[model samples]
Target: MFKHLLPRLRERSIAAKRPVSLADMMEEFWREPFASLAPVFRDGGYPAVDVSETEGVVTVRAELPGLEPADVSISVENDALILRGEKKFEGEEKKDDYHRIERAYGSFSRLIPLPGKVKEAEAKARFDKGVLTVTLPRDAAEAARNIPIEGA
Candidate 1:
């Protein structure tokens, strides 16, 4: 009956030995009241992305399964690339019996910072087989240039 007390005692003993900061105490004070509701505010980082630079272009690819191209929007603002989209829930069929539904459906927005300036007018995006590919060509002024070394 008292087996659980051992673990609690050990935990308290271990915790008492460590130095605690004011910030840690404050965080614990605030966390206990909202710990049960924490899951509701979690961001799962949906629609994962990959950003790569090759030659004179920067490319970004996002995984958006089960969503049409029309459901998403892409924009470049203030040197950051923004991706916004919503995956609406499908109407449940009366005959379908489901045990568990883990798929996430909702609106999400992701802002990606670019390494260098890009030509927004020349930017192109394509969606194929649940993947979005965006290519932004680097601006002429932002391109890499070889500097000549002068011997004095």
Candidate 2:
């Protein structure tokens, strides 16, 4: 009995050293192939977005790494704020020996819808240390509008 159990324990130990079984790999392969190829945004590959509203001003913050100030473009159209940029990779690599690669390199765009109309001339943006912060102040006349509702 003891000898039989020893063989079984050794088999289990050997199985643990192996990478993965074929059945497991096939199950994962069929599950979601694009899951591994998904784009990584800031904040663990999820787009970093934050919005704050003051008495009359709204602030938006986004994190964009590996980008220069000139590489980023911000535009407001139809009350939607668009942030677009490209994170480029310009490193020399040997064709024969590339062990691993995990960093993301490509263009990314983030669209943020403003809660209220903003003054385009008064909007401000600053990028520092991979973080971009945008401040949009609302127009005073537009901010003061209070639509009265008639009872239906």
Candidate 3:
């Protein structure tokens, strides 16, 4: 989706001090739409996630239905938050009877890039119901600040 790469293109444009044309953006989209997303989609994007920031804390929430807290592992590595887990659901078995199972099962790992540096040691995680929430306090020095314009 173009929306997913808009921010990246904008950042690149700013860094290069040049405007990114629509054609350029489209070229990038066409070149590799699935370059980074192939793995995620291939695995069904399990445990769908939502990342948000509030005040000085960055929160990552993931939907992990049918998974127990013990079955999941959370870690921050290589400037990314890594979530790894397995989902296992066994179908009922009756003597000499075949049953069709229509549920997803297997292992999955999701890597989410951090917007800025975070206090990894101070991070906290909570799992309630079928959701997993991780809160990481932003490193003050790495937090975003507005730049003042010099000319009118």
lDDT per residue (tens digit) for residues 1-152 in model 1: 65656566556655886325444455465857676565655554556889999988999999999999999999999888999999999888889899978788899998888988999999999999999999999898977679999999
Computed on alpha carbons, the lDDT of every model, listed in order, comes to: 0.84, 0.77, 0.85
lDDT of 2 by residue, 82-141 (tens): 888888887867775867768778887878889878998999999989888999998777
Candidate 1: the clashing residue pairs are none
lDDT of 3: 0.85
Where does model 2 exceed 4 Å of error? 1-26, 29-46, 144-152
TM-score of every candidate = 0.66, 0.67, 0.64
Better of 1 and 2 by lDDT: 1
Residue-by-residue lDDT tens digits, candidate 3, 1-152: 86888778778787987658685556667877766686767666567899999998999999998999999999999768999999876655566465655577989898988888999999999999999999999999877799998996
- Give model 1's clash tally: 0
Clashing pairs for predicted structure model 3, backbone only: none
